[model samples]
Every structure is written in structure tokens, then in C-alpha cells.
Target: MLSNPYFKSVLWLLGFGGMGYGLMLLTEPNAEKIERIKASGSNSKQSADDQRKALFMKRLQEAATTGAPVYRPQPQVDKKDS
Candidate 1:
């Protein structure tokens, strides 16, 4: 087998190719977390009621310290009647 050039070269090339592929796989493993990020992004918008409550509480806190008027913002006017 030492004198057969074809067999030696074929085996050598195969071994090198396998080592390269293995290294690549090890360095960059798989991950599929895009679905979680996309789901959270869509749910980031706070509801109108929650926003109003938060703002009211903030105003109340300020009124206690500075005696400022505590007022909630007006409700949004929905233009679409359909």
C-alpha cells in the first residue's frame, strides 16, 4: 500500500476534508431562537387601560410631593368606523 500513490492520496484528501468539516460544525453550532424574539416583539405594545393607569399613578405621586394636578390623558379617538 505504501507504493500505491492513488490510494494514499485519496485517503489523505478524505481525512483532511472530514477534519475541516468537523471543525466548522464545532465552531458554529445550531440555534433557533428567532420565534421567541418575534413573539415578544408583537406583544410589546401596552393596552390603553394599562397605560392610563400607569400615567394616573405617576401623576398622583407628583401631586403628593409638588401639589400638581393629577390628570389622565384623554382616550384616543378611533377614526375607523368600520
Candidate 2:
């Protein structure tokens, strides 16, 4: 049974998978530290709605600066057109 090629391949694949999982567990602490470093770089801490408003304001400012036409579709247009 030990000499069977199919059994040997299955055991090899399982061993590699176990080793990969173990490596991920071992590196979890470093992964958390990397995440903390990434999160610390942000300047403003705003709520979700506030963040969305800020983004909208930014796009409006850009449009005004670049003279891009603002799209205002007629309310009478059917939603099916979209």
C-alpha cells in the first residue's frame, strides 16, 4: 500500500497544505502589526456619512475647477432608461 502512487500523491498534498496553514498561523502577529501601521497613516477620522459627503464635495470642487458639466437628468425620465 505504501508503494501505491495515488496514495503517495494524496499524502504529499495534505502535508503541504498543513505546512502552509501552520506558516500562516505563525505569521499572524506580524500581519496584525502591518495592519496597524497601515491604519495609523490616516489623518482625518470621519464617520461614514461624513466621509461620503466629503467625497461628494471633493468631486464637486473638481468639477467646478475643471469646468466639467454637471449631469442633471430630467426627473421625468423613466428609470428603465438607466
Candidate 3:
């Protein structure tokens, strides 16, 4: 590998070019994507609401087939007389 005359020079130039591009990125400011992300909140809320509605519909379907209530109660916790 050391027999090639341009080996060391090629590597040196490649490393310097990579560092230059990195420095350029560091000095440049990107704001459009940041603002878009900050403004993108409604989709998550909408998705969660849609999922809950779908789950409610599924439970309703099950309840309509059976005669049980769609809502189930949590198990009662027994407490000792403190």
C-alpha cells in the first residue's frame, strides 16, 4: 500500500474535506424542520382519540353480542383495620 505515491496525499485530502463539510454543518442553522416538529402536536392527540374510539366500538360490538356491560369493574381491594 505504501508503494503508491498518491496514497498518503489522497488520505490527507479526504480527511480534510470531511472535516470541512462537518464544520460547515456546525456553523449552519436549520430552523424549518425544527419549527415543523414543534407545530406537529395535533396528529398525536387525534391518533390517540381515534384509537380510544375504535376500542370503544369494539367493546360495544362484544357487549351487543353478549348481554354483559361493556365496562368492567376493578377487583375490590381489602384493607385491614389499621
Query: Which numbered prediction scores highest in TM-score against the true structure?
Result: 2
lDDT of 2 at 44: 78
In model 3, where is the ten-residue run with the lowest total lDDT? 40-49
Clashing pairs in 3: none
Candidate 1 per-residue C-alpha lDDT over 48-82 given as tens digits, one digit per residue, 9 for 90 to 100: 88788888888889788986555654567889978
All models, RMSD in angstroms: 17.9, 12.0, 13.0
Q: What global local distance difference test value does model 3 have?
A: 0.83
lDDT (Cα, tens digit) per residue for candidate 3, span 1-82: 9778799889889999999999999877579877776788655566767989988999899888987776785478999899
Question: How do the candidates rank by TM-score, highest first?
Answer: 2, 1, 3
- Candidate 2 achieves a global lDDT of 0.83
Who is ahead in TM-score, 1 or 2?
Answer: 2
Candidate 1: stretches off by over 4 Å:
32-82
* lDDT agreement with native, every candidate: 0.78, 0.83, 0.83
TM-score of each: 0.34, 0.41, 0.33
